[model samples]
Target: MTGSGIHLPMQSIEAQHLAELVEQFLELLRDTEIGEDAALNRLTPVVYPEDADASAEFADATSADLLDRRAADARVVQAGLVALGEGPDAPQQELSLAGSEVDPWLRTLASLRLVIASRLGIEADPSPDPDDPRLGVYEWLGYRLDLLVDAADELDGV
Candidate 1:
């Protein structure tokens, strides 16, 4: 993090992997309908956990807008990730995120992590059997999310 924003150094493969993940996340958001997938349910919180009817009503009223904003945030992440590289051409790239881009990146990372975690059936367990290869993407998102969060915290102090 600099006086302006967070500058990330990423390899081409890393960039491509991140791009793919975000793309999948966007597809999940746009493609899945409410109650269709448990993973999608992770994106929306139960406002009234005790009252099923109220919770359903709350979700019915707000879930669409909430998911839409999440999609928008994911787009911002995709845009910032454009600075990262892919293929043998660039091999490597740097993305320096500043101003409004920071929050969207943070939110998108969190959302992606949540959806991935939900799909993996990982609740509070910090370590979800590293032996499971499928958990790789979930761990990766958490790692990236942590980096941005720490950087964002530094900027907050400024």
Candidate 2:
């Protein structure tokens, strides 16, 4: 029996529970205050620049910025999840403000979403996947990064 008290093969893990888990993970990351060096090391290259040196710098910068941004975004997503689970006024849930994966399941989802979005030039759908933490993080990160990237693109255009 799972924490939710309902079990049906693989269907036991409900979306609400998964969302709660994600919230918890985000909260931990926000609170722990992991160093920037560790955060940068964990992230692999996504879109590399033409210049090898420049690409490395880009990756480093992106990772650092993302580490902080993701933590904030995760808090928002977690709040949404909590509201969905226990109603809007359940409690004032807080996050670490640092950033960390709520579950191992979300890592691949984040990578895949970024790849697909970059390739297709499309924003990801906001659907939440409870079974995979990676997908949840990806969904949250997608919207957040989209805004930042769009803003930068606009500034560059100007």
Candidate 3:
């Protein structure tokens, strides 16, 4: 059950990858100080693809794609956590979600963890937080858009 065009096995989810992604996202949060939105915007695509693009033909996405991906990723995270037996019945670990771009990122990462745990034959529950205040348009998304447009433009320029 390998993901299409993706190297990892779709059915054999990897918790490590999910964890690493979370770690990287946390780093981005740390790098982007409070009041700055650059970090989250840049990593938006990787964290959530729905907000990457929209209104385009085939395979196109909209800004909401980010939220969609977050939910999907959360499913993966649940799979992983369940696999590890780290769930409601298990001990809760401390996770810091401070800084300008931390809460949303953490939520997305948590979702991914559940997804991974599920793929590994485990049960996990990841509830979406609608009250998160960091849902604003961050510079990070613009940064990624800049790179994507630049790449597309470069190819077109060719």
lDDT of each: 0.83, 0.43, 0.37
* Model 3 lDDT per residue over 122-152, tens place: 3344333334322222223333234434433
Deviation (Å) of 109 in candidate 1: 0.9
Where is model 1 more than 4 Å wrong at Cα? 1-3, 86-90, 124-129
* lDDT rank order: 1, 2, 3
lDDT score for residue 124 of model 2: 46
lDDT of 1: 0.83
Candidate 2 yields a Cα-based lDDT of: 0.43
Model 3 is weakest, by summed lDDT over 10 consecutive residues, at 1-10
lDDT of candidate 1 over 1-158, digit per residue (tens): 33688777666777778889889999999999989988889888898899999999999999999999999999988987774543236766677788678889989888988887887778876667777775998888788888888878888788
Two-way lDDT contest, 1 vs 3, winner: 1
The C-alpha stretches of model 3 lying farther than 4 A from their native spots are: 2-36, 45-61, 86-158
Clashes of 1: 0
